[model samples]
Target: MFHVAALGELLIDFTPVGLSNAKNPIFEQNPGGAPANVLALVSKLGKKTAFLGMVGQDQFGLFLKEVLEKNNINVSGLKISEKFQTTLAFVHLDKSGDRTFSFYRNLGADMMLNASDVNYEVIKEAKIFHFGSVSMTEEPVRAASIKAAMFATENGSIISFDPNYRPLLWSSVEEAKKIIGIGVKLADILKVSEEELELITGKIDVAVGADMLFREGVKVVLVTLGKRGCYYKYTGGEGYVDGYAVNAIDTTGAGDAFLGAFLYQICDMKMDELCGLNKNDFKRIIDFSNAAGALATTRTGAIPALPSIDEIHNIRLTR
Candidate 1:
């Protein structure tokens, strides 16, 4: 049985091909989208995983599908839309390898996904259902994603959400906050970045941001702090794990890698076991996830950068 089922966008990212050139800055195509990247990481960790989303009946769509298959992710729930084009994002990375996105989506195929397109049976079979806030930026897809999360919860599946909070994709920051808050309330596990925490709580302190989220019904809150590692907090627990020191090449998928590892660990344990996990157990899980995120930053791209289970184990063993 698949441990996790993720639903959202699967698109192509055009990253700079080489160092910035005066004449023309070439670009390379990479398979991306937060949910899809998480799916890839889960699969890389030797976990049973599936992805449910829509892609266009285009070459880029084919590329995205191939990427999922190559990573051993089940793509049976993937829908192909003939009327719309696949979504695309142009990613620009500064010298520090920090990224900024310029998206080109006009009711793209990914956002065209409707509730009818979802495979409710597959979602019911998974231990956890994971998603992100990007799909909430639009209409039918937003409704569809919320419906899926609700159904997953009703069927006893743990819901994990990442309020990935891209200001560019949203109509306004206030609107994004409102909608994302709804998602956080519905999720059992919530992942946020430092900037996302500040935006969501208007607080610079991570502890305060996590406390606010816990009060709103989020059972667990993970704050990814890039190089500083990640912070994990729950209703009755709190801790910080220092990140591994690595030569970070690109940080595009680090957060997804971290979330994927965390979800996989939770899914591997029985629901009753998870409910009974002690603070020590939670710390170990978050520490392992933090290492996964750090390793991802040492590589390029998103899906291709995720570490395998053996790699994660070896890294931990050495440390």
Candidate 2:
């Protein structure tokens, strides 16, 4: 069975590299999109993964397909759109490597995916099915994402969700909350940044926010606290795992790295085994994930920045 199968956008991220001779920023094209970033890290850890989404029949789209194939992820369900171009996000980073985005997707190819285009076979065969809110920002793809999640759940696949919310993609905060809430309800494992936890639960306290998710029927809640660490609440227990210290150059895909590493460790476990994990068990797992996220930030791009298993271990040893 596939370790993980994800349904979402597969797009390009134009991350600034350096300043041009004219003092303008020079950007580099990086393979991105949250779900794809997660799969890349999982594949790095020797997991079998698949990507299901739409990309334009263009240069960037073709390049993304090649990147996934090279990373050893199954791309058989990745569709090429003739009507729209691939989505693009220009990432602007501050001194601390925190990022903001400017998107070029009014009607991007990823948002064109219809429910009929979903690969039920991929979802059915996956041990864990992952998705994010970016794909839920618009039509067709929104329906496609929901359909895949429901199908995966019905087929006994563990559903993982990350509300990698990008404000530019949403028409209104209320709309985002509504759809993202649906994702939260479907997830057996839900990963969110601290800010996202507040966005979804309307509570500032991490524990309280997690409590709200638990009440919503979510089995696991992972709240990522950049630089500080991660807080997790499972069915039987909860705890916080401190983050590793690293010279972060870009925090673009750090969260994806964290979730991917976390998933990689638990992908093979049964539902009962997952639910039975206590605080100590989660601390060991989240610490490893924290190292992966920290290591990803030491570099610039998303997929290109994912650390090898050795690198992750070395980072953990520093603690």
lDDT of 2: 0.93
* Top of the candidates by TM-score: 2
TM-score of 1: 0.96
Give all TM-scores, in the order shown: 0.96, 0.99
Which tens-of-lDDT digit does each residue in 135-249 have in candidate 2? 9999989989999999999999999999998988999999999999999999999999888998999999999999889888899899999999999898778878899888999
Name the weakest run of 10 consecutive residues (lDDT summed) in model 1: 267-276
The candidate that achieves the highest lDDT relative to the unseen native structure: 2
Error of 1 at 201 (Å): 1.7
Give me the runs in candidate 2 sitting further than 4 Å from their true place: none
Error of 1 at 15 (Å): 1.5
Q: lDDT of candidate 1 vs native?
A: 0.88
lDDT of each: 0.88, 0.93
Q: How high a TM-score does candidate 2 get?
A: 0.99
